[model samples]
Target: MELQPLATFRVELAPVLHVGRTRWGDRRVIGIVGGSFSGPRLNGEVLPGGADWQVVHEDGSASIDTRYTLRTHDGALLYIQTQGVRHGPPEVMARLAAGEDVDPAEYYFRLFIRFETGSPDYAWLGRTLAVGTGRREPNAVVYDAFTLT
Candidate 1:
């Protein structure tokens, strides 16, 4: 299958709430404050109140679990969920955790994206499968999403 450019998302985040180590792993909840997304097919602002519930495993790989809402320019509301992983060498991960501006190539961050909506105009999204590559900034996470065709 080929990949087609879908959209670029820049999600703003609040400070992480450390939940300590649970039976699963080191848990952290990051508040999704606000953000924006744009592309050929979709453009909108990310609504607040969503969050990422992250679990960092023993091997230092993080399980990316996020759910959020998107309001398209024309007024369609879409539900978005993403699952993936982010991992790298010790030093690289450390740099990222320290909020350094390291190159994305220094680590691996990828996601599988899904969308759901009741709006007829955006119903196509319900059947669309997407993937994304991510980068962590000091206060935001940015990613470019591509739809699988």
Candidate 2:
């Protein structure tokens, strides 16, 4: 008999984006570093690991209550569902695999977040908000990727 390992599902802490809103024509930044469930004590601690999230950093962190459709490494994209976008280095993924600490700057790019709110607003950011991913998404989703140059 042949043994195979099915794709078991798991959830991990995603990238913590520095969610900031710009005003005065991008001159000012109003950032909300915390969310609804960032406290020392919460009533939902006994739940499954995925059910409760800990905002370790009050300055910029939150439990992911959102999902996203993203481009896969295979050059295809799918909106499976995402937890949140975290800010860190590629070591985060590596550390998750090896159980080690990694410097946040090691990542090539800062993780951008996507939430599955069913709101059209999640499609784009800032000036790019006008273009929606659409109900019937195209073959390839063009990304106006945000790269810190």
Candidate 3:
């Protein structure tokens, strides 16, 4: 199967709420303030209120889990969920944590994305399986998504 370009999205985030260390790991929650997305077939704005519930492991790898809403330009509401991981060399990860604008290629951040919607115009998304390569900016996360076809 070939990977088809799906969309490129930038998710704006608020400051991270560190929940401290737990048995699982260091948990943190970052509010999804706002953002936008565009592609050949989909274009929309990300609604506020969603969040990323993340867990940083002892080895510095982070488990990325996020849920959010997307409003299409045509007025369809869609639910979006992504699960992924982000990791890299210790020094690079440290720089990223320090809020530096390091190149995305320096780290490994990837995601498995899922979409759900009841609108007939976007019904095709329900059956599509997508994957994304992500980058953590100072206050946002950007990713280019691809669907398996």
For candidate 3, the per-residue lDDT at 43 reads: 94
Q: How do the residues 1-149 of candidate 2 rate in per-residue lDDT, one tens digit apiece?
A: 33222111222333333334333111211112211111121111111122212232333322333333332222233233223333343435445335444443443221232322233443322212111110101111111212121
* Candidate 2 runs further than 4 Å off: 1-96, 116-149
Ranking by TM-score: 3, 1, 2
Model 1: which residue pairs collide? none
**Alpha carbon lDDT at 30, candidate 1:** 97
RMSD of 2: 18.9
Model 1 poorest ten-residue lDDT run: 93-102
Question: Which pairs clash in model 3?
Answer: none
Q: Candidate 3 at 57: error in angstroms?
A: 0.2
TM-score of each model, in listed order: 0.98, 0.21, 0.99
